[model samples]
Target: MTGAALAVALGSTGLVAVGTPAAYAVTPSDEVAKLPIASFGAMVVDDAHERVYVTDGRRSSGESAVLVYNFQGQRVGSLPTDQPVSGMALSADGATLHVSQSHRMLTFDTATQTRSGASFVPYDVTCGRDVAVAGGKTWFTETPYNDPYCDRPDNIASLYGVSGTSHVNTGWQSQGRLKLAAGPGAPDRLVVGQAAAGADANPFLTTYDASGETLVRGPQRRFADAEGKGALDLKDIAQSADGKRIAVADGAYGTRLLDASDLSDAAAAYQPLPDGAKSTAVAFSGDGTYVARGAAASGSTPDLLIQPADPANGTTPLEFAFEGELDGLRVAPRGLGWSKDGTRLFAVTSNGNGGLWLHVIKPPAAQHDSRFTGALGTTPAKPVVGEPLGIRGRLELDGPAPAEPVKVTAVRKDADGTQEVAAAKVAADGTFTVLDVPDRLGEATYTLRFLGDVTHRPAEDVTVTVDVAKAPTAVELTAPAEATRTGGVEITGKLTGQGRALPSGIGLKVTRTDRFGTTGELTSASVAADGAFRVRDLPSKRGKTVYEVSYAGDALHSGSSARATVKITG
Candidate 1:
């Protein structure tokens, strides 16, 4: 009877309905720092120097500086850049941080936070630049125009490469701006995604082999279903430490996990964010232990989450719900960064004012394990179609008690295909019940899962199959032995049904067969609340006649029949 979680069902409508369990920290926020300006472009964490750098993309911030902080969020120092800074990246060796400015790519030493050198980009930067380091060089996106022409296909948004004090134009062109991503071991892996500012309806996302002399295009993709429902709204793209998987932060869709080889949807996807929360940024930690998802949202809904990188693992993420002015509202785009060891995470948040805050968090390194005990059982021994059914089971956790109760998610697969059940709450006693109504007769299977939390590891799935039977319904009849031809004969019957009440005012199908072996249709008898019905028929020929009553089954009931015979006198 004791449980800590709330019960909320995913309505039969298939809309997502997440229960708001109390939020508990996997680990408390280590530090919070106020940024020099609210304007943010991106963040990069330097594990080698034990520092983190954040860029201020405000072109009018006067003298913009790359704000620097220690791993603990203590303000270490700032490297003053002549112009506003935007996208940033660190070298494979982690010795230098590459930052993009209006017309130049600047380099700074992570060890001393000092500006080292700069290379001029070929074009006049207007839409700003996105920078990344791969194949032992720096790559960036360039847009030549300064006004509303940024989205023009003629504007010729291009990619440029920088190495050894030389700026080499890659000659790759697109209608709009491009976003770039490359990590420590992914030198050969360079990703460019389109952001057309509304011009390009179907923007392309392509990967390149930065390892070779000429950039070789790898897997390329542009998404739009047959009905054109899912379109890519690219915000950020991150590669796993091993460079096998790519996670795209899609505003139109939730976080998309894609295989880096072909850019296809991964086998399993992370559970959706609470409704109304759009993906703003996504990144994998350097060690590949966790993946962080940032979103812009309100209230108790999460604005940031850190979970396992393997979607198939289904671990509940360590959640962060950013509320009012005390700590910014939501995570800014490209606001997430992690230390190489996956021990420290940096999140940038905006307060809607001209203010920004940096948060430092440490996630649990190891998870407490969990398992579901006891065989699954239903309240009623046998279930009938169209009736509420409850499948009960118990979940046990190995570690200390959870900060809040956990929940178990389930899916029901029947003749109608698969449907998600409303999540069930795990009681303090580890007991929870999966509730659903079987819509079809035959066998249905329910699969229950526990995507573990910061406190626990994911449990193996348990399945239970159920047999559903049609509801029973019958027709009862009462008749007179004989009747005169002058008075029409009246036949009476009652209809009874089981499982949810049969609808009122139902008509039973009736037919009459004469002694001559000719059959004819008769007016149907309407059944009342009391299940009583009567119908009259006059025999054209004086002979024996048979009246047959039948009730065809509905969605949940089986059909039944009744018959009566009468002899007529002339």
Candidate 2:
């Protein structure tokens, strides 16, 4: 609720919905800064110096600067540039930052944020470029054209290795734009994926052994199936910390885990993303303990997911839904970066309207245990149809108090099928109340869930079943003591019911009886919104006459009737 804390509600359609109470922090995280840039090119985290470098790739000809922010997201300084900077990568030792601009490449000392050196690049293209550090050298991609043609399929994009004041053409080229990824886990290896620019329909993903003098290409891969249905739409790439595996963020597919050597599918793949979400960026933490998967999803769908790097670890992910102007709409392409310690995750998000934000998140170092403490209890021992029922339970969570209050989600299942109930806010004492109105009779089951948060693991679900009974309805009648045979006998009455409001325009059955005990059915009386109705009838038989009003119950209420005695005179 204070500082950079945000309250993000997780969508049910997602694989994991980590719901948090409103006005409460979604996680122990913060949106550190609203980046003052129209477009995002790249993000690089300098763990050694506790700084972050973000480039504004929107500018082509005008002078721009690489925006620098401290770990807390405060703008510390900027490294001015002659032209807009595009791609960036941090050196293996964290001493140098390799940045690529439209015309040339620049290096900066991570500790001082000062320009260390510059190198000449052949192409002065405005299509942007990608930079990476591998084999004790700097590597960058060159898209040889200006705007509008940057994404053309026939555009010549080449990979070049920075050598002191000049760049050596690696002689490797691809159509459209090229993306580069490298990590300390595989210092000698560089992974490349063809961007989904108007280039190759089935873009290729390959690796190169950069340890040698010449760039030796490694396993190459294409994703198109026999029917050409699954073409690679590369958005970002990441190699595991140990270099044994690689992860690709393909818009066409979800996140793809591949063997770093053969590019074959990894033995285990992550679960598919929430529906309607497309992969945009991914990164493994410097320590290889976690992987941050970024997506471009709308509404409540999570835009970012932080989970265990190893897919086998079935730990539920901590999800973040970025909505509104302040937080941006979704994670940007290649927007995820992390500190080497694996504690802080830096993500860049962009709204479709050209707004951007920088989020600095601190994932819990350890997840604590949580559990349902006692048997679930329900109020109004006997639940009735069309009435509110409250389910009460206690959740015991370990570790310190949550940054924000947690919530419990509920679902109701009956003969009609299952439906979700609104989430209940957990009180400070770990108590929560799930409220719902039962609409059907017979047995109804309610299941409650606590999906957990960044600091706690999920608690086992609890369920309670109750028998729902129809609501009781009654009719009251009032009549005059006597009436003439020729004159009509008038009666007035009211209908009353419990739980949900009774249906409007109700019609009650009416009957008339004389002193002889003979009874005859009469016209029905219509009830108004106020449940009041009037009846009029003539009594041919003299002496005593009786008028009765009755109501037959619907699916939600039980039937009831009332009678009034009246004297008749001829």
Candidate 3:
């Protein structure tokens, strides 16, 4: 049918017509920063200086300097070191940055960005070291050579007292490489855990009393099922501000929240991660209000999640996925760090190419609720199968005006099953229309949703039911089975339509063709209130005569035709 004819045919049917984009849409995540780093080693956020320090560990790179970036992600300066840097730690007052080199420990003044002091006389340090400040003193770790054993019982990894002489051990020793974390403002509380190594079957984690000069080990842990199924594959650990809770990034599990006092499971835990993403890092904001969890995932999978620290809040975490060229594929191990105010999070991402990128992301931490207002409305009041449909409703957001137009997604459920409808952008006045072309012919239920952005909470779902129907028009004919060649011969028929009643007294053009070599156009029949019509004709001759009747379709009803055969006996 021509476009003009199809438009006229559907004019009275009251089906909605619309124009929309054909591409599918995803949640928008702005690219805030893309630092070109040759390699990724460590990332630490300095709240006091409003700067972030990153380094290229002893990998394939030969440059021996710590790259510094302000909270906004601009390259500020570099802290040149004697050797490649490993673990980085900040003092309790945030004045000094303690960096661990191969065989020595160095401290940098945050105010001057210059080296303050250094220490040596350490055992030949081949394996990189991890450093931290605890118990009002600085401490460092030492693992012999570059080999981390999994089965050895020897005291290969030892803890040292760095406050005065880091060259000597504080008398705490373990079998594998150890990682450290301290509660901000709670130097007395220290957390140490074993990095999963080649030999240790059950890695250990314990808290320590750092208020004293001596190391006092506290509640210890090594998670394993009865059959030793779920052993701890520790990547990173973080201490809460209140010194009451701890969060661990476990490769086996996602994020595990533990009680600070006993190192047991906390009353609540973090939500499960999106599929195919494993826990690579975890950190609690300095204020203890939010937590950032990092995962090594690709494509549209979430690589970072920032959500409420308290699992009880149950707020959906803001998600970030890095894809496309110039974008990293996944989050590196222990790659997420947060600023003091939770305003910014610094992440290190590495792509398939040997390059790495430093990303400064500001996740949505504040949210306002949203709801639909008034009654739901739609275009073309009654819906029809294979026709465009428009469901319109107004959304009232509790937050300030958004930076960009808000989008509303819709899903339809019917006999064939559920399908996702193309998302519609809301207008500045908060009115939005969801358009769809329903493929099925049964009851179609539309469920509209607002996934909410960085500043808004998801709106409550709105549902509307639509009755879809098929287009109308049918024909039936009646004639004597055997008609004589007389003037009494008459053919009658009835026309019917579905959706709306046909226009009364509408004219239906008719045609008649005899089985013989004779054919002629019959007079147009006027339809009656009962939708019945008739045609009368006289047979010129006789053998068999065929009478065919047809009605041209209209705006609301399709065209139909019927034929009757009579044995015209002479």
Candidate 4:
């Protein structure tokens, strides 16, 4: 199921937890900082030093700098660059940071925050490049040519491995911009994907065994279906903590989870993103327990989701909707990174106005148990079809109360099929009422669920079966006590039903019994929109006459009849 949306409130240095009631006061645990750069390029986290490095990717030959921040979201320092900063990666030991530049690859000492070394690259690239620390060496990709031509499909791009004073061209080349992803879990493995900006009808993604002296390509994949639909629109990619799975954020397809070994679809995949959201960034926690998926969404739609790394886990994701001036509205592409302990997530966002923001979030350390403790009770005792019924139940949550009340979702299963009922909000006391109007008769079962939140585990589902009976209907007749034989007897009646409104155009059955004890059928009377009907008849024999009006009920109503006597005189 899609996770619930939580709107985060940003302060100068803190972020208040969402998903709680507005009236509840909350302690700010997360951090948010306004980025100084106008454009976002990449974000790298050094868990050892608790520092985050973010770069400005906009092409500029004049001057650029990598903004640095601590785990607390405070600006710690900056690394000045003669040229624009592009892709960046942190060394496995967290001792060095590799930064990509137009004419060189610069390395920074994480401890001293100073340039450790600089290696010359073969190409002076005006277009930004991608850097990754893989195969026991530093590798980067170059899109030959300058700014405008960077995204051109005809541009040639190549991968190079960095050595002592220069870089080594791996001789592997492709058209347009190429992306690279490598992590501590898969240090010797390099995952690469092509950008759709290259005008490739179908983009390709492949893996390389970087452990050897030379780059060996393995398991290549092209994502176009047979009908030429569903081509890959890659945004960001990441490898699981164990390197057993790879997750790709495709704007056209949401998040695609695949087996890392062969790039095949994983047995299980994460749920579809919220509507109107486009995938932008993805990252796996260093500890392999969580994966953060980011998207470009507007309004209250979530732009970031933190959930279990294992797709099969049913735990609900912790969602964050970033929509504030201090916090960017959407996540930037390739803007997510996590600390080694899987405790903090670093994300970069752009507000579409050239403004960028950085957020450091800490997930809850523990999840408490929640359960439905007692049997559900329904209002009105006896449930009738077409009538509103409230299912009352109590939920026991073991943890602290949520800022906002939690909701309980329910579904009704009947002969016709299953139907979803509106969610019921749980009060502070852990009591809730699920209201639904049963449309079908006979046995109907209501199943209520409480999908867990970030701090609470899911509660065991509880169900209640009910026997639904049809609504009762009645016919009321009004007739004169006496009528001359020469004058035709006229009778007025009304038809009404409990629960749902009675249908219009109801034809009531009418019969007349004369003094001779013989009965004859009269013309049926059509009911008006107000449930009123009229019946008129002329008796051939003048004497005491009985008039009976009856209605045959429909599926949701029970039948009923009424009678009236009129004396006829000559």
Taking all chains together, each candidate's TM-score versus the true structure is: 0.70, 0.77, 0.70, 0.88
**Runs of candidate 1 exceeding 4 Å displacement:** 1-27, 123-126, 148-154, 197-200, 225-229, 374-394, 407-449, 461-570
lDDT of 4 by residue, 296-330 (tens): 99977778888888877666777787777777889
Q: The CA-based lDDT of model 3 is what?
A: 0.73
Best by TM-score: 4
Residue range 72-184, candidate 3, lDDT tens digits: 77898899986777778888888999887877788899999999988773653445667778877877787765444422445468788674434667778777678888867
Q: Which run of 10 residues does model 4 get worst, by summed lDDT?
A: 9-18
Q: What pairs collide in candidate 4?
A: 20-403, 20-404, 21-403, 21-404
lDDT of 1 by residue, 46-136 (tens): 8888988888766442467888899998898888887788878898888999988877788988776788888877644446678888888
Global lDDT scores for all candidate models: 0.79, 0.84, 0.73, 0.84
Clashes of each: 4, 0, 7, 4
Candidate 2: residue 84 Cα off by (Å): 6.1
Q: For every candidate structure, what is the RMSD over all alpha carbons to the true structure, in angstroms?
A: 8.6, 5.1, 10.8, 5.5
Scored against the true structure, residue 187 in model 1 reaches a CA lDDT of 72
| TM-score of candidate 3 on Cα atoms, chains taken together | 0.70
